[model samples]
Target: MGRKHTPFTSLSRRKRRAKTLHIKNLIYRERDRLGGIFFDECDQVAALASGRWTWSDIIFLSQDPAIFWNAEIITANVAFADAVEDIAFNEAFSKLNAAETQQEMHLDFTPDVSSNGKRWLRKPALKYPQFDGLTFNDFIDKRALEIARDNPPAIYCGYRILPGYASGIGLQIVVEADRLNRAVIETAIADFRARGERNWISDVPARVCYSDKTICTPLKIKE
Candidate 1:
């Protein structure tokens, strides 16, 4: 025989349903917040890729602790680093080939005359490969190259959190795929909140890289 339904049982069921709905709503809210952060990070990467800013400019902007703590932001930071490295590598490859031929690459800079005509205002040259019809600076910034070479931006592998506040936490924020889905959103939200709650303190901000094995250190922000 089946058991009879009771008012108490109905009430308990309603409460369970209500609690589940609340948690679902909370997850959705967190997802939206994380989605926003992810897009903002992508925008920063786009700006750098489009030549709106230099590697130095991006590095300087990323130094803020607020930017570094989040998983989404770290993922974007890794993307930006990869983009810069690719750019530098391509430029070097092209130059090496061009150098072998000993082709004289012309400087594309057009000197603008000063108001008094006493001096010329030289605009910063674009750091890109020379094209057949286009021109580029003949000289390369050795210092910039050195910085890029030595401190190749690390990939966001994973993170580590110790028991005490003094030990601090290490996070390697990485998003393997380009596409964002529910799982990615949930993970991002969790990591972000975890880092925030921990309040990791340090003299220098932790440097994240693409590789899991790399020893996290502070990046040299200044060029």
Candidate 2:
């Protein structure tokens, strides 16, 4: 499985294009890299913020084992105030840390990602990746650690690991170890149907077995 790059109309600047996907400030117990939190509120920056956050602030969460994080991605309007945790899952990542683990994931806040490692968001990205497509009641049975053996698209976080060496603690994307193939196809269809974008798909080349069908994958992350 290898990548077949999808060429697009080159952009003059790579700014975050306007997104129709709503956002929210996911909220959950900061469980030492276990999962995410309740990222939905009215007074977002002021409600669940530990320090100062902004309407455009893109926060990062480091889950221990760097994988198997059970978090929620709430889709809100523009800011945390309008963000809504539309989906939640406890699964593996797809690309970033293809084959790695950490016991204690950490969380940091920074404005610049000068050193860590990352690229811009490319084509054929996942549209609405869910845990089990359970719709709040779908309990995950990742009892099987499966992942897509394909390399998905990625995006830069605009900041890097403050400590420098992000071995197991770097940026990543989460992909289910069990349903990667379908995931790939889903991505293509979504992009075309919703956004009128056509991109390529592949099984990928960066996946490593984490054991028992478990794949520590991410959503097109980098080191």
Per-model TM values vs. the true structure:
0.26, 0.13
Compared with the true structure, model 2 gives a TM-score of 0.13
Summarize candidate 1's per-residue lDDT along 1-223 as a digit string, tens digits.
8865432223444553454344344334444533323212233333334432211111100122222222222343445455555665456446545553343344333445655565566445444444332234333334234445676544443433322111111233444433334345446446546555443333333343332111122232211
Q: Give all candidates' CA lDDT scores.
A: 0.37, 0.24
**Best by the lDDT measure:** 1
Candidate 1 at residue 211, lDDT?
23
User: What TM-score does candidate 1 reach?
Assistant: 0.26
Model 1 regions more than 4 Å off: 1-111, 117-120, 123-156, 160-170, 179-183, 189-223
